[model samples]
Target: APRCSRDEAEISPFCSLPEHQAPRCSRDEAEISPFCSLPEHQAPSCPVCCGPIRGLATRLPSCQRSRSAVTCRLSGTLLDEDNPPLVLPSGHVYAEAAVLRLEAAHGGGAFRDPRTDDVVTMGSLRRAYFL
Candidate 1:
């Protein structure tokens, strides 16, 4: 069966049993969407890319890693969609190829989300934001 929309799921929590057990909410007996259950402090998380969660994890995967920081590339258009076109801290203009190269250069690591200060890939971006 097709899953309902997020708003509908919010309104009609009892209507379906998630394939995974229903997530307990910290607020409102009126069940919260599993997707929205993460504590507010742990934001900018990309669940799709980051995969299964454990407990109230409050930091991004990037924050947990102890590696030298990688450069993130962005175009004016992508930046416009996500944020204002302020000059990059790195002062670089990233075309699509540059993004591709970034992925390659990072040894196929995920893209770091500038907005959220998290790491996410293109596939994860589509799932978490678009869907």
Candidate 2:
């Protein structure tokens, strides 16, 4: 007896019998099956074939480590997306307004980077380009 595709087996009354198991269909048979002739019978719900599924999972974009580091220490708030960030010489970045407030509170003297013990000044601050 000739084999039928899973799609054809699902719809054909001869192949649906519990006593008569249908054989797997070849690529050529799959293309010419009676079930493949119609568009509505092509869905996965029709029947699951005994073969590996193609492109089962989709790929996603990689995560950005820098974006997760855009939190301010002084204000405890996230950096503004529109504003450029202030990068300290000690390699720490913070919101511009927060750094300015800290400098003002300390009377324009050297302030410590919370992440590191290194002393930094307003002159040591520069604009950072974070993507």
Candidate 3:
């Protein structure tokens, strides 16, 4: 069966799924799609890329690890579209929310670096962009 796009330029294991089972979201649809965050409409997350999910197992094949998965150093969770990995000036990486929470716990604008015991301010944080 023809499971992938007719364009023939891109190939992925996702091509094997039925039309209805294909991903509901596309990279360009973020600004226009309304169902991106709806659980029933979201595609199943890859197990290896997403780490351990609670309550229910992931639908992504556990046997094959995604080559692009990058995990957050503090939480060990995948740095995916939902949870971005932010970087501190001291050369440390952490989840976006994790850094924010740590700063808030200390005093709101400054947080102690988990690695070097140095104080890092929110102004020194940088966004880590991934492909």
| Candidate 1 lDDT by residue in tens digits, 11-106 | 445337774654433233333346544554232333422335432222211122233222223432343333323222333333444455556766
Candidate whose TM-score is highest:
3
Better of 1 and 2 by lDDT: 2
Stronger candidate by TM-score (1 vs 3): 3
Using lDDT as the measure, name the better of candidate 2 and candidate 3.
3
lDDT accuracy of residue 125 in candidate 3: 87
Residue 51 of model 2: what lDDT? 23
Candidate 3: TM-score? 0.48
* Of 2 and 3, the candidate ranking higher by TM-score: 3
Give the range where candidate 2 is weakest over 10 consecutive residues by summed lDDT: 54-63
- Top-lDDT candidate index: 3
lDDT of 3 at 11: 29
Against the true structure, candidate 1 has what lDDT? 0.39
Candidate 2: C-alpha lDDT: 0.55
Clashes of 3: 0
Worst 10 residues of 3 by lDDT: 54-63
Q: What is the lDDT of residue 50 in candidate 3?
A: 33
Per-residue alpha-carbon lDDT of model 2 for 11-110, expressed as tens digits? 4555555544634433443223465335433334222321232121111111233324455645656676654589999777778878777777677766
